[model samples]
Target: MLRAIIVDDEELSVKRLKRLLSESKDIETCHTFMNPLEAYEYAKSSPVDVAFLDISMPELDGMALSGLLLDLDNAMDIVFVTGHDEYALQAFDASALDYLLKPVTAERLDKTLAKIRKNRGYTAAEPALSVFLFNGLRLCRSRKGQETIRLRSPKTEELFAFLMFRRAISREEIVDTLWSDLETDKALKNLNSTLYYIRKAIGSGQTGDCIEAGRHEIRIAESSLYCDLYEFERLLKQIRSAPEPSADLFKRAEVLYTGEFLKGKSYEWASEQTRRLEQDYIELLEAAARFHIGIHQPQQSLRYFCEILKLDAIREDISHEVIRLYTELGRKHEAFQQYRLLEQSLQQELGTRPDPRVEDFIMKLMR
Candidate 1:
């Protein structure tokens, strides 16, 4: 996915452009700012593939911002969007890859993206490294008409995963985490050998560059690899921050969370991340449930609530929500069954009764 930032002083224009980009499904908006100065500051700290700038804003214009952004990262691509047609020459002079006239059309945006992709040597059809951490650890590089490459190595895979998790780590940390029992010199030698095997297993062409090792530290390049965990967390953040959550966005994010992070793995360091992501997944389900209910979609709400209960059966509030939704849908029998399950779970797990509010709701519903 192309990481992009959109800058527009106008809120409506920014929303419209974001909607269009979302529909395209190729660009991921890392940040959006009404102030060009703030956008420039963000671009300086983050790796952005493209900057979509609106030219007529006060304080700082898009053309000026493009120069600043390019100064920070000469490799960053810029596309100018403005209402004024005459600014096209100025935009090109500022080294913009493309100049877009205001009231940007989808077709025009598509053409502009095509130009950017071509100029950047980005092939939409290139094989992408897919790392699966939800069910178990699996790595595959996939391309349209080519055979998939499956990467396999126990120690090397673990090393790669550890680096991906930490982003960067000192050699001492690597030895402590992955080879703690060995002597310091042996651990250091093992780390180097494992890294070499990792590079070889994942293919030295692109994946080799992803793991950078210095004399003292090693880091996984964020831009050079794609992992499901990364995407899952990103989508969760997007869903949480959306001004108005839609069913489509919720569903898009929901699908990315296939299961718990590295579900079957017992890596000590992964346990905390696994639990955190599981909690976030449960919350996402709860958010979807509430959103569906707000929209008067009882069945959809029930579906999400049921999923939440599956992950966190002892959450009395969610259990109550499930019961309420089932009752709302005239499935009183199922509602009672859910209540019984909740009561049984609470009693078995905590040796306590259901919360008073849940009991009250059940009693009232029955009457």
Candidate 2:
């Protein structure tokens, strides 16, 4: 059992975390402080095993308060509990044991406590770090439910994503890829800061071992990291190569691609790969649509067709198919709406009207 103290400026936050700590068997006594100075004062005389500090506090922030607490007893584990996610680098720099985001869940707190235990040599640390690139860049831990990691800056995210995608990259390549617009000196300095942020974000525990940085080159320890893109593409390959792929296999691969590769981020290097993955997604949707058609489920097939059109509005073939599906499902009005949407999209995007044949086809189907 360990003695723990939580310091947060918000009284509600302190109470909430204290309640969560109450459920933990590893924690013998839990103390709460609404003031950072008071928490520091308490730690001065009474050395606790764990100090839970809120990063954004009044008088003295958690980072500074933690430094003072550690000065008293370096063995004391510091866990940062705060609403802001950007303080990860500072927290790690202060030698914090773990970082927890706001509205802390019981499960996440358990993981933090587990990390403390691992630090105390009570148990071995588990490889819980994972990178999720679909929909956006998400660095998640925990297999049960995601504990997403939010990095401090876009450069930090890009550096981590670049490293994850390449696995290993030269120092020159990193600077060229990420900092080509800046002078060599400034670029190198930025790279150094970004690299430090990456390592700090990963933490100082066993998970830290996943990223191996050297003078000439830096590489990700593939064994320690579980990247969703890797598994997603692997599933796609398996499903594509199979003689007769099952619907279950298609569903598995389809769900893994939550959205286009790194959706919403304007990363030049990722544009090509994003396009490729989108093409793959469109193809998967096409296959699923055809399967639904074969089974006489035009409604289900229509859904897949609409999904494909959402990704590529100028897909005249899919648009025609959607109109036909709507007509066949006894919704001629919707078929006409689909046709008008296609016409507008084609006109606006391609600077050309939809093929006359599409309107003709819709007319015949409606009649």
Candidate 3:
């Protein structure tokens, strides 16, 4: 992983770089400096192998920062994080080894690193692990179906999450996940047991054929699996390939994102998947609800509309929509009771109140 710094006075540019870096788990630290002087101090104290510097600053310019870095004899390298190409050219004039356009790209950064190693003799480290292991090599992969576990390690949960997300993985990958402190033979036994348990879980009810083991590779039995993760990804691909956000796609996403995938699990690999599904679910739920409303399926619409509230109760549109459906259908008592429950839930879980739209719905229903 690369430990990097964004030394630009512009907050937006720094934010963009930080976000792009986040997509790469290879990054360890991403610091933002809004002032040139502060960045200069950091440059002097540390061996900042890769410095993202901006030109046209209040104090020292990007050129000077790069010059000072090389002068430190720390083998520090510089990448110009500048807005205009002209600024990059100016910095290059000051002997800045390399230059990058604004809105730093992961691909360009990779290219820059490759160039640096070739000329300056700086070798980059290997990329970080796709899966992390912990807690007795109980492997879990997200890429696979509720399928069998092929690998076991200290971070088996995270490993399983990865495999669940990915279709297959190999034995060497599994062994590398094992902790160095354990005896090799005993570790393999535990690994087999962990795989057995994962298969049992996947085949428990939904499907009996969800895992396939081979000589060196193990994978999810994609032939007949009902993975929420797989369903969500399929919907995403459909949405992308579609001409527009169709009603069908939204509805599919709504039902597919029933609950946070792997909810209440402490595995780190599932965290990112949970967040992504939650975000997509919220957006698609509103669209799906609208489609259902247009088709006069308010009861079904109400089901979806209410489900959205469970994930994000603050969205007043969903609450109001559900309440109005109950009222217009002459179910006023249910509307009021639902309001009470919603209010109590918000107060208890979020320590907040429902939006005024919810209260207004109660007023409408009271009549």
For each candidate, give its TM-score against the true structure: 0.71, 0.59, 0.43
Backbone clashes under 3 angstroms, per model = 0, 0, 26
Q: In candidate 2, which residue ranges exceed 4 Å CA deviation?
A: 1-127, 181-193
Error of 3 at 275 (Å): 2.3
Instruction: Name every residue pair that clashes in candidate 1.
Output: none
- Shift in Å, residue 174, candidate 3: 8.6
lDDT of 2 by residue, 210-274 (tens): 88889889898765767778767766755564555666666777788887788888999989989
Candidate 1 lDDT over residue span 258-306, tens digit each: 8877777678999998888888888888899889888889899889989
lDDT of 3 at 269: 46
Q: lDDT of each prediction vs. the true structure?
A: 0.81, 0.82, 0.64
Candidate 3 Cα misplacement greater than 4 A, ranges: 1-158, 166-227, 240-258, 349-352
lDDT of 1: 0.81
Candidate 3 residue lDDT tens string, 1-367 = 4567778888888887776665443456777788877876876776565677887677788777778767874456677878788775577777666888865654565567676666665454321111212112222334322223443343545445656665787755665554345677776666667766655644434433455667778786543434555656656655543434556567656555545666556655456766776777776776667767888888877887887887786665667778789887878888887788778877888898888767875776567
Candidate 2 C-alpha RMSD relative to the actual structure:
18.7
Ranking by TM-score: 1, 2, 3
- lDDT for model 2, on a 0 to 1 scale? 0.82
lDDT of 2 at 301: 86
